[model samples]
Target: MSVQTWTWILVGITFALYFGIAIWARAGSTKEFYVAGGGVSPLANGMATAADWMSAASFISMAGIISFAGYDGSVYLMGWTGGYVLLALLLAPYLRKFGKFTVPDFIGDRYYSNGARTVAVICALIVSFTYVAGQMRGVGIVFSQFLQVEIIWGVVIGMCIVLVFAFLGGMKGITYTQVAQYCVLIFAFMVPAFFISFQMTGDIIPQIGMGGTLEDGTYLLDKLDALHTQLGFKEYTTGSKSTWDVFAITLALMVGTAGLPHVIVRFFTVPKVKDARKSAGYALFLIAILYTTAPAISVFSRTNLIETVSETKYSEIPEWFKNWENTGLIAWTDKNGDGKIQYIAGSAIDGKKPVYTEARGSYGERLIANASAAKNELYVDRDIMVLANPEIAGLPNWVIALVAAGGLAAALSTAAGLLLVISTSISHDLIKKQIRPDISDKSELMWARGSIFVAILIAGYFGINPPGFVAATVALAFGLAAASFFPAIILGIFDKRMNKEGAISGMVVGILLMLFYMMKYKLDMFGGGTQDDWWFGTSPEGFGTVAMIVNVVISLVVSRLTSEPPVEVQEIVENIRIPSGAGEASAH
Candidate 1:
């Protein structure tokens, strides 16, 4: 069968599987809706957490970022994965021990203030909505690309499917559905990778293939390094960024990962504190499988793409090239109006000087004008590398179809997780906690569904009208999460003396500073120019690291100057830390 037809079949089967599981596991009570009745096994919870954590960014964007980012992209791999270590060791188990259904529940009760809970709720809504927008768009993009539907129609169809499962079963439905998504998505990701690895280097494992020798007996990294040098680019492995910038970006990602409301809320489904710890450990293992493999995929795909396109004449470029080119994902302009395409360094532009100079060429000497000098420039969107991997490597059509379904699964599972957090914050945190403590469970559930319905429309709008590239949007979202919520959650967990004053102050400072910095560079808030740059030359993607440090410093300073929490609050912190007194387990 053709790739498009096979994609529909694979996607159909996957959706049927998800819907069946969701209906079979429909939620009955508020506990089921919020925490899956606290009976999830460590392994199941780990799988669900993996699905929750791996959003559109991980599935569709990260490899693309790495493909172009070279050494600088290591920050994302290190930052995102490293954050889980902090989550497992410092936060997840304790939060689970606190035995709350949602993040706001812990904040409100521990701080003994509804205002603190409200702040947490607002922060959660902002982060989750920002995140969901990208996931929905990812789903639409994959559908439109592989299944040949219009983007808006694809998005609408995706939203209806998600609503069916997310609203019907809530956390109870999302859990099992996410588990299935984890299976489909992971399998889809690895299969083409395996084929590509073997095709390139005779290596079955992509992680090894990244550093392995190619069929020509040359090192893979060496070839990439050589290609980059020829292209007026830096070395593939070592970053050009300052140590402080790297450190800050990595730290921000770690803190942001630990603080993510959707991820943290997954732990609430585990039966006990110890189970949460075990689940986190397992979740890391699952996530590591993909994270470690992603760089390999990036390297292999980039190498393959350059070699393939470099050999093709402009007139003879394949149908796939024309298809993606129409999307503006791949564009070529012949500066000299020559019919033949030029793939060369220092000659892509008509009058601009080469990006590299011989004096400081650490990536090695350039091979200027290696191809024809029509000075044709090729602009390939980073998002295409991963999605087109199977076609690039000449893998089977089924594999491509499977990847399309997998991409949708990854995006949908994450969207569901984010929407759940958004809805819960509005219904449970805002309405139940503050507006009407005596509201019926039915009313709260009704509000939760209503909030999600509204959130879907708003998030869908952003998805259709995305502000920037997928990875950049996601990075900014992470930056926001790092700034607003990471410090509060960490202080609440680790420090007995951290008061509501400290938490509130830290969140405000962190989020506002991050927003200001991002807007300055991204939206030209302070006038667009080289002069309106970051304080230490950090890119907006890496600015979260700075914001996180600021948050930690401010939180510590404010807490030290203020009085400690009351005896009750101190005991609450201690209780969260311990493994005992985790209440009765609910039915699985």
Candidate 2:
């Protein structure tokens, strides 16, 4: 079948499967809507959590980031993966034991103040909304690019799916839908990876191919290293980052991952504290399936991109080239008037080579080798490497269609999870706990569904006109999470003396600081026309690390100077630490 025909067919099938699951597993009560009736098996919950955690950023953009970020990008891999370790070891079991439907409940009760819970609700909303915006954007981008639809129309489609899943079936619906999504996304990601790996390295498994020998009997990585060195870029498999920056970025990612409201809320789905622990382990293992493959895909795609376009004439490039070029993702300026594309480290304009500097110029400028004519430049969009992988590797049209479904699956699953969190926070934490204590379960459930619909609309708007790439938006959200929520959540769980004052103050400080940093970097510095204006020479991506540290320190110091939680609050903390109460802990 043609790409369009296959895309429509695959999309129809995918929608049917998801809607079927939602129908089969529809939630009948608030409990089911919020936590799938708390009956999810450890394995099932783990799988759902994996799907919930791996959003469009993971499926669509992570490999692309690594493809360009080179060694410095290892921070993303380590930080994102290592976070599960922290979640399992330090957070999940206790949060599960607390038996709360929302992260705010833990903070509110532990700190003995409704204010603390309110603060948490605000933080959760911010994190979930910011995070969901990126997923929505991913959904729209995939549809617009692959399906040849308007971005608004793509977002509308995604929003409708999310609404049906969240408002109609709730967590139960989302859970099963997420499992299906995981399968489709992982298969779509791996099939092309396998083909490319085998084609390049004679290895079927992408992870092994990443380290295997190339056709010339030299290590693939070794060749990449030589190429990078030849092009005046950093080596492929080593760190070129300052030690402190690497440490901070990695630490921030780990904490940010653990503290992500969407990921944390998944623990509530398990039946017991031990089950939560086990589910976390399963989540990480499932995550590793994709995370490990992502780097390999990055490397392979990077190599393929360099080889395919380096010396080729722009006119002679494949049809895919023109398609992507139409998206403004790929561009060429024949600076030297040469017909051949030039892939090089520096610019050659009017017969003069001008050095381009952005620090991590790891992928050298494309220069046609030894061409006497004007330099033919090729600018490939980073997002293209993953979405177009199947096409680039000469895979079938169905494979490309599968990828479209996979991208949608990844975006939708994560979006559904985030919307659920946002809904619960509004309905359970904000409304039920604060505004109307007498609200019935049915009323609260209705509110939750209503909140989901509103959240979908808000997120869909951003998705249709996304301010930036998926990774850029997600990274900024991570910074926001780190600044606003991570410190409060961590201190609330660990420090006995932490009180409402400390928690609330910390959240405000962290969020404001993070916003300031983000605005400077995204709006004024790197994003705006003003170049050479980074604070502390830190990229916006790395600034979150510093922001997180400040948040932690401020929270700790402020807590020490303030009054401690009440004796009742201390008992609440102790209760959370124990594993026995989860099974019978009454729902709020």
Residue 296, candidate 2: Cα error in Å is: 0.7
What range of 10 consecutive residues in model 1 has the weakest lDDT sum? 360-369
**TM-score of each model, paired residue for residue:** 0.91, 0.90
* Residue-by-residue lDDT tens digits, candidate 1, 1-588: 988789879989999999999999998888899989888999999999999898888988889888988888888899999888988888887777777778778888877888889888887887787788788878777866765555666677778877887898899999999999999999999999999998889999998888899878999999999987886677788788888778877877788888888999998897767788788989899999999999999998888777778736666765566655433345555544454445555434332222222241122212232223545466566766788878877788899889888898899999998889999999999999899999998999999999889889888887776655566677777888998888788788888988888888888788888888877877567764353357887777678878887888888899889888899989888766665455433113
lDDT of 1 at 431: 94
lDDT of 2 at 205: 95
- lDDT of each candidate versus the true structure: 0.80, 0.78
Per-residue lDDT of candidate 2, residues 163-195 (tens digit): 887777888889888888888888888888888
Clashing pairs in 1: 83-254
- Number of the top lDDT candidate: 1
> Global lDDT for candidate 2?
0.78
| Candidate 1 overall lDDT versus native | 0.80
Best by TM-score: 1
Worst 10 residues of 2 by lDDT: 353-362
